[model samples]
Target: MACLKLDARALNGLWNADHWERELSDPRRICVGIAEGSDNLSAVACGWIVLDELQITVVAVDPEHRRQGLGRTVLKQLLLDASSAGARQAFLDVAEDNHGALALYGALGFHTIGRRSGYYRNGKDALIQSLELQTDIKLN
Candidate 1:
């Protein structure tokens, strides 16, 4: 997994290229997972540390790479890194219908905190979830 060196071009290689340049250029913290021995990215997670909270703006895995634990690994790493950076909590929004993501987050100790109606461009509700990071707990 790549962290500090992640850029828009690398992110675009895994998913849509549209407007990624601007998103990646933002000052917020970001993390990315790349397939070993290749330039292809398997997962990407972006967020920022605000006070004691790490507000995640995006977490995505290539469709082809889904169900392989790549997303979980990426998120786990991000949480650990953020916690080490002085973030005590982590938050993210997941589409209500995204069962895979919901399951992943749930397994990682995140619980629903609230919901946003019509939060997505597709008009789907978003489930807001948060996790208290135990920085001392190591992820398996």
Candidate 2:
């Protein structure tokens, strides 16, 4: 996996265009994890840090790479990096029907804080989750 500074082009490539402006205008609010392949990226995770909160904006793994633990690896590293960057808490919203993501976040110590009805374009509700970061906790 590759952790790199994401620019607008990279963010675009990773399927996160909705927040491109925010990510590009402020460098500190962006972190991207890439699993590089010989020809392209196999997985990607993007997040932002604002004040004491780390918001995970997007995470995607290629269809062929699903269920391989790549997403968990990326998210775990992103949380560790966020904590190191002074984030006291982490937040993310996952589609209510996305069992895989719910499981991953649950395993990482995130608990549902709230919900947003019809949050997704497809009319699916989003479950907001949060994790209190402890410096003493081991990420791996």
Candidate 3:
């Protein structure tokens, strides 16, 4: 729901967003999302962003909430926020088999900027995409 706007089930155990909470507490990496609701405190669309480059590192929505456009909403807001704060480029990596994710990123004005071969644990390829920073990058 954040980086790639993907669902938790689809993501399987490929990632652990909570484990990153401590890492994101740092100023360099950003994490943002809506609370999961009363008592959970866990968030929907937990995203990891590289503030300096506006790169999206991770994002996932709980399986129960899939297809609600929450993923898109979160991703869009993050990009907008990055732009507002000043970022000329947003980058990300995705498993090549994730066609849906590729499509969403394309719709968001992100384009393939590079590739890292043999990069996945399963030996699948990884596509590196980038969203051009339309505005000058500035992080104050």
Q: For residues 33-73, could you state the per-residue lDDT of candidate 3 as single tens digits?
A: 65454333223333344545776766565566656766666
Q: List, residue by residue over 1-140, the lDDT tens digit for candidate 2.
A: 22222322233354344455565457776555554654356666668888988998877666666798887877787888888899989888998998988988888888899999999777999999999988433455
Highest lDDT model number: 1
**Pairs in clash, predicted candidate 2:** none
Question: What lDDT does the true structure give each of the candidates?
Answer: 0.74, 0.72, 0.62
Backbone clashes per model, in order? 0, 0, 3
* Total backbone collisions, model 3: 3
In angstroms, how far off is 16's CA in candidate 1? 7.7
Candidate 1 displacement at residue 77 in angstroms? 0.5
lDDT of 2 at 21: 57
